[model samples]
Target: MPALEITDLTRLYRRKGGEDFEALAGVDLTVPEGEVHGLLGPNGAGKTTLCKIISTVLLPTSGTVRVLGHDVVTDTHAVKLALGVVFGGEKGLYERLTARQNLDFWAGAYGLSRRRRRARVGELLERVGLDGRADERAGSFSRGMKQRLHLARGLVSDPGVLILDEPTVGMDPVAARDFRALVHELRDGGTTILLTTHDMAEAAALSDRVSLIDRGRLELTESPGTIGDLVSAYERVDARGVPDHVRDRIAALDGVVSVREDQGSLVRVETEQPDATLAVLRTLVDSGVRDVARSRPDLEEVYLHLVGRRGMGVDR
Candidate 1:
């Protein structure tokens, strides 16, 4: 079953100063069951606008959205019960309450029974590493701790669909890793997730398919795999076992822009022109550089490709 669908979705704001600012410019999207679909864009790309409309917190200027087969405009209460939403960053927890108590509060709001709520709360807290901190008030917890509690609160109701907006935004490295693993575990257990993120690593890691929104329009939507799945391809060159002289020569090539060393060995090169990059690779065949490979493309590349055009030539 399709967990969510949007057709001709749009939202526009009329400022008090008397100008019209369109936040969404006709978005069309679908999310199937049991997968992680990423809604990714830069700061003002309108991903949050789309999510708010689906979650029914903000009404659309014009569009149709159905969550779990119920029209958002008509069946808002039902949709709320069937879905969970996690927004990015510092959404306050009831600082006086313990992690377990926060879950308890949401569970009561969701109308779960006393026994069932306790059971579910325990399970969720354990899953999110808050079992140890269940009794601690939210105000004293670290940033990472708060993020976990936010996720656990969303799952307290056991909603069929999850909306996670930048779930790992401000977490420490270890915390971020743990949170992503939790997301993967949920997907494995048949929870459909619609998520957004500014972190390229986070988006690439969690997204089964990703929609790139730019300037309030659907720039592209496709799976994380398949070069054809994304809107553009980036030049990737794996420079293996390069001597210093050759490395400098390759770096000085016209199209080469940046180089990232992996494990201090192989380097991934970002280039302006792939054809020229390949030509550079061809010349190093006799220089003991045995391994060379190129990717069709990835989100980081697509981000730059689109953001470059849209961002006054500033690559993402």
Candidate 2:
């Protein structure tokens, strides 16, 4: 069975004296076992709403969600038993409790016996690199440390499917790298993961496949390399000291997507075909423009092209 199955899922929020908002509109997604699926969307794009519904923290207004073959609505207990959820930031940990104590509490909540909880807590602390500071109060931990603790808490149940909602939001570069390595370890051990994040590099680095959501709808789902290939179909050429006539000529070339001026005298020409890019370069080089270069777009550029640059903030 797929690790997660979401079909025609929708959520509506009734506003006070305002029009009711539909956060998710008939979204459908399926994640297979042992795959790391990345969810990417702008702020207010229903990513968080989807995560909450899958975790059973919020009910969907319509449609069905299943985790590990257990329907979220009809089998909450089984879903909970099979899932682990970790949201980004340091807000979920108990301030006064030591790392060991916090993990112990969460394990107990999952019905682990006292002896089992002790063993599981220690195992988790070591797994997340918190064993050295297992006795430190959670409040005394740094943001990275707290995030590690959060991950440990999420694994207290040894769930099969894990959902990480921006799990590296405020982490330093080093910490983020370590966290990603840990995720790789989890996936290697046969854990299925659903990761939502605004970081394009992170999504590209860790995901086996990725789904893009926009304005309460899913736009596309593809492997990261496939997405890269989509953008690779287009090429960009940047040149300096190009005359207005050359710029206009490049703009009129076939397959040229756009020609825009950057800061100062630099002009960027985006083209949809290799011939177009070559033509652009030939035109510039023939015009005595010696400072021209060609390159391909990355995942971030594709995201901005697909989703546009607007409403990029925390989801409501």
Give the winner by lDDT.
Answer: 2
Candidate 2 total steric clashes: 0
Write the residue-wise lDDT of candidate 1 on 23-94 in tens digits: 888999989989899887877778888888888899988989998897888999999999898887867589
Best by TM-score: 2
Per-residue accuracy of model 2 over 200-295 as CA lDDT, tens digit each: 779889999999987788889999898656666778999999999999999999989889998988898888776898899899999999999888
Clashing residue pairs in candidate 2 are none
Q: What is the overall TM-score of model 2 with all chains considered together?
A: 0.86
Residue 175 of model 2, lDDT score: 78
lDDT of each: 0.80, 0.89
Given candidate 2, what's the lDDT at residue 280?
92
Error of 1 at 242 (Å): 22
Candidate 1 at residue 244, lDDT?
A: 76
